[model samples]
Target chain A: MTGQFPDDLPAGQPEQSATHPLPAYVPPPGDSPPPDPRTAYAPTALIDLSIPRRTHPASPVVLAARIVPAVYLGMLLPLGGLWEDIGLIPAFGAAIATILIALVAAGFGWWSWKKLTYYLDADGDLRVDSGIFQRQARRLQLSRLQSVDAVSPLIARLLGFVEVRIEVAGAGDSRAVLRYLTKSQAEDLRTTILAKAEQRTKSEDATSADVDGGEYDPAAPPNPANLANQMDGELLARVPMGRLLGSLLLRTTTVTLFILTVLFILFTIRTQGVASLAVAVVTGGVPLFAIISEFFTYSNFTLSRTRDGLRLRNGLLQTQTRTVPVGRIQAVEIVAPLLWRRFGWVRVQLTVAGVGGEGQETGRAVLLPVAPRDEALAIIEQVMPGVAVDDLPWVSAPRRARWREPFQWPFLAWAATDQVIATRTGRITRRISFAPHARNQSVRVMQGPWQRALRLATVAFDVAPGPVSLSALQVDLPTARGLADAQADRARLARLHQA
Target chain B: MTSHVHEVDAAFAPPQENWVRVSPKLITARRITLVLGSLLEVAVIVALWLIPGIPTWIAIAATAVFVAVFVWAWWLIGRRVRSYGYAERETDLLVVSGILIRRLVIVPYGRMQMVDLTAGPIDRWLGIATVQLHTAAATTDAAIPGLPPDDAAALRDRLAARGEERSAGM
Candidate 1:
């Protein structure tokens, strides 16, 4: 691990971790283990428990497990006349080639693991340096650290090792990953990092308050923001197995497949033909894949709020844990599909910077797969304090706008406050999206000829990663203009003096 | 026509008329480029007609359609260029364009991440440049084209200064 530094460090300087031996950062308030006296005596950086250095050994056995899949595919592929012509010698040669390829892959994996290393720097930043040839180093400021999670694959679980993923604020695609740490090391690192981040934010917030003459708003609640900042992995929402299964079966794909199957059967009986076999197979395959996808996505969903931000963990075969920093979330959305609405359940999703999965791993954008409506609302309140979905004065489209959406526009409405602009749209599914004013990238008011004849206009608020625009169609033009001006002013003020 | 008793006001009417229109010279510039592009299409089709055993009528129809489109486009070129306008508001910049599918984009000064000035060969020949304002969202259409070089430079500087001051607060 020390050998991989290459040119990033000077020649004579010893490892920073060995010299500092970790400091005495304070432990978090509740449910944290009592400080162990062994490392707690540091008095400088280890206010919390100190994590001892542990490296994931380069074990070749883990990659050797891949031979099973390789052998299965080798047998599955050589099925035609090529097998009949091949004698025992050629067959044996193919098997040897597969084994050789698997061995090479396992060797590469082991060598790569040998190069990865992570340690706490003297400045309390978690420094991770990995890469066999490129040798990249990442230093995450403990204060800017958001959340850390311990994940275990099937093999890793069997080996009693867990991978730790560290999420930081404002860094795009730069999350630190330390793979195959012992479970205790992963857990200890997560707690210490989160606890130290919580402590730093509290002190920073206090200092800013002092800088502003300590004039706290009398009307506001007594430090809800600070309270939210101090959370230590409180469970916010958990989806029940029954609701997950129910939501999976209740999707529109099921109905579409049923209808298509019925039509194919009817046509086959009438014409005594099998030409529709391809159609039937293709139509039937879609719903089956959807069911399998939902099962894997929402099997054991759990959402929690911690000092780091909102934490979401779900998936059955390959679980993923994502933490989005509180400040980095551009918008929040509560969506209730038509079928899910019958059971009074809604899914809460967020558009967060870095974690919205612009390209890869799209499941990270979802905060909750399926939860009771009240629970989803509660989780929103937990993440975004002061902004309540029910308290805002929602203004619906005017009565004249009935010509456009006979039933939906009456339910569609938009509301804005100093903190957030919330829009409620859709009739059957019913979605309410909330975006903070400071995060708004742009806004537009558009009027078409038909809409102009009715004095209706649409106002769109362009927030990154989320494009749920709010439209008050068929309202008087003056009212639309006034609302646009007011929203522009409010958004400008929010951006000018960010809190 | 039967119902002048509508209770609503005209929503399509913009609030103000202090909009800055594109440079009138842009019309001549675009016409020259359009004619060149049309001629290129005609050449490609006539080349295909030169091949033996190919239908001569096909090339004739293609050439005829290209000339017709060129003439029609030349007629509407002035109104299309005149429709492009932009306004600098107190907190946001409003850009309006298009004749059929009218679009209005309002970009708040604080949200601007970059202000770029670009001039193509034709635009430089016409002594005009285009200013593009890019925000965090990639989907934003916030460019104002066909401005005099001096005016474009002034606008870019002002937008850059305002962007700096506003982003500092964030």
Candidate 2:
């Protein structure tokens, strides 16, 4: 039955070459291959919920490593000047104090690690019990599980451990982090959680089948074995190192910095003296840091399709594996910078419901950092499934709107299909955002004083916060009203159809 | 002015002219708050005037500005209060407000996560309350203020029931 899905594969395929690496699932040393689908629910040794599990024993070392550098720098740098004034004995005492602090932090870390234990409850809810004094116990419902990501910071990677982050729907703090698990253990845990979550979702769907008018078949439950073989999923897109670097360099900020640096050098030479270059350094440093960070974050970015959802693996210093479940994406945006357009490149960003607040440095919202136009469209199609990007009945903003956004007016357009509402804006960067009608939270029509005078309005389709922002700017008043109303109606109908 | 009103009506028209206008007492409530705030500002300026070496003209000018602003706000309050209206459609709730930046927000019942009913001291005294609809997206700012307590409660119950029936997962 699992073979019907072509992407699903049998367990334990040989690792792919290093050039295009895949997350090869290596089962625990003692356990055999995953059991057959027809068998009753049997917890494997790797994912035995009856036993409470602890992270790697080196968890204390990892915690100490994270804290020691901050302590050393914070104590040593400020005390360096004071040490000259205070004397050698006190300086040595200060150094000893810093070591004591580090030791205390490590001790606390060890205590917490020893105390912390996580297990899956009978209802398939993940319960994490921790805190030395408070004894905090958190139960995360599997039914609301949005995504499960395995993240490895540089030090954690060196120590052969990964942090499994589970994000559930609702609230900013709706996330669970299982820190410092072995790489294989993290993989197994992610697979088990996702499979269980899928089963829970299927069961819920079955229960709601009456409301859904028998749209969901209760008989066809997902095969956990197939989901465990996520390693063998087909690769959809992989960003090359060269393209990632090129895209970073071609950013508008990089260009502006380059121009500023040249002007600064020329001015200095003309003055025939070393001028105050504080302004130049301050201006150039931020973008340079941003570019370097972006490069490190997006290097070796690979996106693949799994039975559970779409899996994204990226990062140089801190490798992160994020799975965005099927139909979980709320919105998608494709951005093509002016410079990148020459190379036929664009970047794809997504707005998943609960996968937010992880910060852009993790590239959580970035679907593709840089891909050719066609490849970008193909990836968007996969993410949004059934929406045609190239072909849409686009309606450009009325001619009067040009007065408001003179340069961007020509590019300002909006399109509404039965499935998605898309808006295009920006003259230089050229951004096109698509929000599925079913996922739209609300519709808004707004008009500023100037827009009122110009008889123009802007319509916005709201979704859960991420990178994608969909709005039709400077549209004619009647058209904007019509669009908003039609969009609301479409959203209502789409929600009904989905139910 | 009539033409402007017509344009606004055309732009933000609900299915019909069935918009349930907010309480008229909202204007009085807002004006009282505005006057109190202005009086506080004037008091601060008068206190600064009592300071040694402070110019009397500065305090007088500040007080005059506050008076002008207070009068302007008082004049605008009624219009702004009148502009605030909400319409309950079959599947969504429409909230239209703001004079300078006219906005009409339509939040589908299925997307509503929570319905909050709140009453400030002045609102409680005036027998009015605010009903705020929260969706998954924070940008969905749909708050209908200055509804009579009974109406607010009834609206909250109706919205809650509809939200439950059409509840969709984020």
Candidate 3:
């Protein structure tokens, strides 16, 4: 049987196996047979969440998200008071209203408390139930569990709690969340989930090997990261403290917060009345609150690994915990924010079978909030030992030229018209800047109509390809042709390796 | 009984689908019908103007807005109609559609995430079903339009039998 970079073919390309090989970087030949995870592994850890659960940690921010409605109603109580004075009354009236609001808050708090518990059944199943208003319960057999995710809000840390969500695969989506599991519980939960998935994968490898009679790589020795680095620990990377804060302050919510805050100030200035003053005060106070809260939000973020899988933990107010087995990861993407171009802060996220599908993939399950270059490398090694990331030559895929490429006629056609119309309205954009991206951005070739006019199209690659990088091809016409040609070419070359 | 008209024409029902076909004419007719609808809207604005009690300015402004909207709607419909196309590849089925950001989704026969045939009121009149194929990567949702409802339903069933995956994601 062949080993050692089987088709070590050219760059940005892999030979599709004459037979789809077990994912790479697995270990060498083993002595005895392995087990079948599906059939042999215990189903104790598996579970499908019954419904949506409240496993979100009670981070003041998350709680605040839920509380926005309540807070709005409370302030508007005066409006209701106007209605009451206009002769709308009932039994304990305002008292009842007040009680109702209080009850809703109390109800959510109670449910958050109750729904936040998650545990594994004996056979390696992970189960979670959450939500007070709408009770949700899910069960995932441990074998199919995709990833263990933990998000620690800054508040959770000061308050001593963390939120954990577990994802799984199959007929129905089964998942569990522990909103405010203790740090220890969060760690334990991740460990247990990882342990279960590992067990199942091990069993599957064993059985599938016996049945198929083909070579399969067992997992790398349990602790590749530590073994590779020795006492140096995980190599580390980070954006400067200043750059990180800049990004946090500029995220979608932060931008909206800033915009509203500015609008409130403008209103406060325009009308020197109590109503305007109150509006200004509330709006002005929010961004400050957000800035402060976000400080602790990403505080103490850390990522490392043991033999089992990768572990990430961080938060100032609320702690979040997440675990992902290397086996579950479909691919990884290293992303750079437009602003981070200055500091070179790259965000790393993974695409796994279960993550990044449907759920916006909340998928950027951040591995490193900010890191030095070497640190990111160390982390990559820990998560994926066989597939290399650091040393390979990084080539920017061809899709970055939307503004200059001849084929960009379509987008240009739209852009030119849009510019003219906006200019006529005196709303001209001073500068229309296209984002500068790195080579290796995920390039995908998807052919729809224009793509098919020439029989090609491509999706821009988002720089890094890890476990879930399968979808990031640039689907431009040439890329599509390349894909078709490459598939055939790779197939032919793979046959040579086998022969 | 089990499938088609001219596509097969061996004397069989078009097929089974949740919604019935309105007619193929709707594809092109809708374009003309929209023009006709815009004319109706124009007639309404003029009637309001002619009726008098209504302010002349409001009628003019309303008519102008309606005309702009009608033109915009026609543009959207034109683009959407033009973008719709589908083709079947051997081991996989391909559906091409999308207006502004066009998409061509390929679902290898066995890689179907989920296939659903749905019909809307207008589509009902057109006798067609919009079939959507879900994949793990939602950005590439493959959809084919204008299939006779019955064929759409059968294709949906066939895809379900052949399609791979959980509805949530990939």
Candidate 4:
């Protein structure tokens, strides 16, 4: 256990020497153009300069995959009894019509695939052109790109194609999405874009005079952090099947589903002379399906460290590879459900910005969906480098906190490091939350009638554009007020340093 | 049994005594709005009473309850207006208000994403405006109402400038 993270962490930190050895902070050459921090896109080694680049179209199999949903809808419409009033002959005719409709949908899918093309422009913006009839083109500046994710569904994986999504900050809902590229091509493209983004940030840092740059050339040296080379790749955590299943089965959702299934079986036995197999099948099948779906979604989960931030890859049926930049994560939350506490397992989630796009589940927020307590803590330490979660000093809740929230008081505690404010709460599903001081938008101290009577208060630290359930709950009134005031000051100082 | 990680810092300094009160015209603004609101309530009740099938006593009782609430609210509005006070600190701004549930919000200037000065029709008529400070986190308590229009603008500019200065490191 070397506590130091990898060498790819952003510059200007004194802790770099403790980690892997890299070049000291070097200033950019004076003669170079003053880099505009906003549009400082510099190409990394990932982009193959020798190769002649042209617009690439998506794989042809994507058309068949895209029309699957429409085919299912068509099949379900007939079963829904849409033609019940009409004769059986008419119903038969409707079924044939549905098949023709499915064919037409497939044709459109083919046309869409043909129309969608992506290529990098001279200005370094990734230009995407799409639309079968109406032309739609979007230019996503590389410097503004926040994240690049590669996802492969079961069908795509089988066909060896992957979908790449590039999220651009301030672009609103119009992020560039290149779908169904060859698996290798998608991987290569993702690395190139991420490397370019990192290079852009380095140039911005140098020109903004934020970093103590000397002669920092991003292209120089055998920089293992180079994205295309992937020389500095280090596996941080891996969730085992046993632990994943244990955490999944012990979840509140699974427990409630199991209880409902038993109740349904009991009701069926009482109402019918014989046990109704239909009720048993219907009630039991849902939870089973949900468990299987969860298993498929998070199986083979792995978290790795890259030069940019963290890289996560998981899923059995639909594998997804996502990169979360160091600055993008606003907060971190670790939850331990009632059953999970016994086994010492926890689920780690993060509050990230600009990644939750249309048609994407915010589930991308989970950094480590399920891991052991020690591993979870380790992941926290690595993701939030320089903040030691293990040795943090907590301000324990008042002794009478138990009288108020009996089962939870023991676990209720909060602490503040130089960079983050951390709080732990809950009884059944214990949650430990950490909010970076620079990212926190405001601090509030609240007192209800009962709490006021008890001279107690709760303090909530809110972050922008993310659901932050991070709070120091049920503390002495004066303590809550004191923390709120001090944290406000601390946050201000951190923001000043950030600027 | 206790392991001391680090000594706690000095206790937080309480808000300064030099708290500036909001404009007194806030009471007039509240009075106008409350009177008009109560009138609307009365109109609704009278309409209900005029219905043929409904008993007159039900509407009369509702009107009585409304009257009692209006009087209580009218008195509370004055106190609420008087309670509003704010203070500027070295790095942050403190806003204090509320009578029953005493509220105190401390928003650092650097954290403010935007500072807005708004004057509604009634507020404009009274020659006053409200200054709102917004952060990435939505904190509704960060508004200071009943400032003179010029004062509100000055406050907004000062806060915005401070926000920019503090956000440079960010």
For candidate 4, the TM-score of chain A alone relative to the native chain A:
0.73
Which candidate do you rate higher for DockQ, 1 or 4? 1
Model 1 earns a TM-score of 0.76
lDDT of 3 by residue, A1-499 (tens): 1221221122312222222222222335684236333212221232233233334344333454444445556645656666567576633355556556656765667656765545555555655655667876666776555456655655455566667766654446555555666666565455445555656656777665331112223553322121212111232333355656776665445666668877877776787656766766676677778777766666666664422234455665455545443333433545444444455455566554333222333244566665544566555654443333444322223444333334433222101110010000001111111111111111223433333343334432222222323332223333343343233233223223322
**lDDT by residue (tens digit), candidate 2, A273-387:** 6653665676678788999999988998998765446677788977766666445677888999889999999998888744533323122367888999998897666545557
How much of the real interface does each model capture, measured as fnat?
Answer: 0.44, 0.66, 0.04, 0.55
Which ten residues in a row are the worst by lDDT in model 1 chain B? Answer: B4-13
DockQ for all models? 0.37, 0.41, 0.07, 0.34
How many residue-pair clashes does candidate 4 contain?
Answer: 11
Candidates sorted by DockQ, descending order? 2, 1, 4, 3
lDDT for residue A56 in candidate 3, whole number 0-100: 37
DockQ of 3: 0.07
TM-score of chain B of each: 0.82, 0.86, 0.58, 0.82
Cα lDDT for residue A146, candidate 2: 53
User: How many clashes show up per model?
Assistant: 12, 0, 118, 11
By TM-score, is 2 or 4 better? 4
Worst 10-residue lDDT window for candidate 4 chain A reads A14-23
- Residue B1 of candidate 2: its Cα lDDT? 45
